[model samples]
Target: MTIVAEPQFHVLAVDDSIIDRKLIERLLKTSSFQVTTVDSGSKALEFLGLVEQEEEEQQQQQTSSTSGLSSYHQEIEVNLVITDYCMPGMTGYDLLKKIKESSSLKNIPVIIMSSENAPSRISRCLEEGADEFLLKPVKLSDMKKLRPHILKGKCKDQQKQHQKITCSIDITAAPSPTLVAGSASKRKSMEDDTLAPQRTRARFSSETLTVII
Candidate 1:
């Protein structure tokens, strides 16, 4: 019997309210994902090992580190980031922007949740690279939407890897010898079919009548 391994997706849930954090954690775990909850955006960044400096130099300097989060908020390998829009320190929108800008963590899918459904806030988050925006009190049904974004991120990563591998190989190696031979054989067969049959002498036309003037 082949035992299939289930993928474990880790989620970082950020909210200022402990109750909300608990609720989101329960929702995510119910959907079969590993969950990590944080009380504030600053703590969330700390867990991710990100430096929270608002300067360009600080951001660049932090991202230079090989191992953990930097000033640019380089993301860890967490599959998803789901955060409340309203937070005490760094807002979800801020975290979303930092994650989107970081080269290492930009591919991870991000979701923003807000108690108030402001169209402008939703639009801004979407424009800044938030994959989905959920209203406050996210339901179990919202879990379904999360999977698609995660799958899309995984597919994109796969495509990038495949592209890199393809580019490193020789383009001349694309046409195999067997494929070329088969193509040539097919062309030859087509030529044979289009050619007209050779003209033959009229059957039994041996008696030729010559007109004498």
Candidate 2:
């Protein structure tokens, strides 16, 4: 009789702020992900290299372990990367680019989280190949909304492959014009810092997670 072990899914979170790192770690811990965090992009890159080396060694030792030759098959393999956009030396964008360009690490999904809400900044990050984006002050609801998609292992290449559907429909038919206008007005009001107290609470419903930032 033989017993087969399930492979563990590993996640790497990179952030410069200790508090933010801790928060993300806690959030991921609450979820099903096994997360490892680093304080710098450079360190994250080094850690990625180490993971690859360890994976190579593991592949060589897999047969040995199955034959009861050694007890060294407990290493975890990283499958995802979460990073902050703003960092000291190598920015998250730069790090993402490096990872996407590398053959060994290109398959890993990279999620970018940042406080900057500039549309241009978010657009640039997405254009540069970020898997997903999360705003700062992350809430539990937002994390839940992102988890399913992240866990699905969908990368930029996969998204591009699915972008051919070009059907447009009038949204007015689905919702009342008054309601739409009111929602738009409320969103505009929330953009003003003076209406900080009137900010709408984050809402979560059972829906497919496919949000881009």
Best by lDDT: 1
Q: Highest TM-score: give the candidate number.
A: 1
Per-residue C-alpha lDDT of model 1 across residues 70-140, encoded as one tens digit per residue: 53344445778899999877899998988887665688789999989899999999999999999989997
Error of 2 at 176 (Å): 36
Candidate 2: segments with Cα more than 4 A from true spot: 1-8, 50-75, 154-213
Off by over 4 Å in 1: 1-4, 52-76, 163-213
lDDT of each: 0.65, 0.59
lDDT of 2 by residue, 68-117 (tens): 11134334456678899999998999889888766545667788889988
All candidates: CA RMSD (Å): 23.0, 12.6
